[model samples]
Target: MSGLAALCFLLLQTGACGFEILGWFFRGKSLTHEDITERAILNTTVQVCRALALAEGKDFTFPPQPFTAESVAVACGASKSSKSFCKAISLIQRKNWNVDLFRFYSSRHHFDDETFIEGRKIITEGLSAVKASNKRENFEAAREKLGNILHPLQDFYSHSNWVEMGNNLPNPNLIRAGTSIGNIAGKYNVTVCLDEIEKRNA
Candidate 1:
């Protein structure tokens, strides 16, 4: 192999060619797991707040763009340091480094290694635990459980070809138990254009 080819292979193995080689695929946006999770949380919170306002005959004011936990908390009349919000964000971010630290990256954690079934179970079980804790008024425990699930859930989109598969929306079945999450490509499947990636990097 040429020196450049060997270097490219090495970079690929180390994930050093990530955004530079795959940016076009994601519309040139290199959203980290935390970024996507935070956005999702903010969006969902806004939607819920709007619904509540409508039901109570009040105006729902959005927290404004570049949303952060503090802004959303203020708009929603919650404390920024609420264990349900800001602390949850911290826990979710830690999943990228804290969970299984010093151990091999679990397939279920990043939706890698084609462990979709196991990964889904992790999410479902975590959600259940969160709900149970919340029912008992244990917000701290609920936040931890929620954070654990969000990490893997967000990783599914980042690691999978859901968008490339022509999915315009999220796979709703992922959150629902006892439903098929759809057929997943096996590990050997060439879901991405490796040659295009190589050419772009080269």
Candidate 2:
């Protein structure tokens, strides 16, 4: 490969997800996207191992890789994390035409919208099974489901005007049932983009 091409590929492998919305999750937690993924997979694997060890007297085995569901399966003694796990993770996190990105960046479908309750439910169910069951299949299933929810949850902050509402903190009640996200402005009076250019000229 050409020098520039090799550098780009190296960067791709070594670089973090610098996309603002996606990177938000890793900002306070890990320096790179790979690290974040490894951490999450490890968390799921550890939880499953712990639960399995407790429920069935099995030994805990760590995840074998930071990428590829196949490696995770080897570590967990599953067939392949699932029939289609690694492929799904790849497709889900793909840059263009990825449903994960589309939904995560969808602002009007606001993060706190009640319609999005399914995401939280997925996480809760997955975690509950991972914590209480000896089934590796069930545990991995939960991990995958929970995996799909996190991007949008982190994207909630970047896509909304929460930073503009004069509060330095995110709304603590974003997804809680029966809680308010506060009274949204009845008017869309905020200036943006072209307005800013016009105002500057005015």
Candidate 3:
């Protein structure tokens, strides 16, 4: 029995076993790794979607649109906006709170360096895709598109950063700017418009 216990401990430390035996010792229920990961994914996905919605000026309470696997793949394959949408969907799907995950991992003596690194990697990939798609045109078009959509507030175009200003400006006008951005995001069904704005700003 002692040898069995030792073997279980070793397996847990090595991440070789699905079940975590230490749960019994810690007065917690045992759970499989896949189960935990799936739950985490779902939680993360919901949160991310909510954040995206909020950024676009929409209420986060609306149910997430059903995202099929094919849709996920296609969106991921699309331009920078699509990639950003994909990442947001993926994170929302995970449904796990990042801070909680960090704490849980730390409690288990696991490092979360990869989590942060992977997030940055995804951002980089999305930026690259957007840039590659925009190479054919100058930045002016992108800024114009954003300005057109955000015209309700104001209209200013930034060529260097590709930002289109609506009536809401960002410094003396920062709050209004954020409000305009959120409202625009909420109004659009397709995420491509917002994605373009992000690409320009990037």
Q: What TM-score would each prediction reach against the true structure?
A: 0.69, 0.41, 0.22
- Model 3 whole-model lDDT (C-alpha atoms): 0.32
Worst 10 residues of 3 by lDDT: 152-161
Q: Order the candidates by TM-score, highest first — what do you get?
A: 1, 2, 3
Question: What are the root-mean-square deviations of the candidates from the true structure over C-alphas?
Answer: 12.5, 12.1, 23.7
Model 2 CA deviation exceeding 4 Å by range = 1-42, 64-68, 79-83, 94-106, 110-149, 157-175, 180-202
- lDDT: which candidate is best? 1
Best by TM-score: 1
lDDT, residue 188, model 3: 39
Clashes counted in candidate 2 amount to 0
Give the per-residue lDDT digits (tens) of candidate 2, residues 90-197: 432442123245554553333454334453344334434434432455544444433443344333444445455555544444434445556333256554689789
Better of 1 and 2 by TM-score: 1
How does candidate 1 score on lDDT? 0.61
Estimate, for each residue in 121-180, the C-alpha lDDT of model 1 and write its tens digit: 887788778778878999778766666776566566667776556565566666667889
| Residue 2 alpha-carbon offset, candidate 1, angstroms | 55
lDDT of 2: 0.44
Q: Which scores greater on lDDT, model 2 or model 3?
A: 2
Candidate 1 is scored at a TM of: 0.69
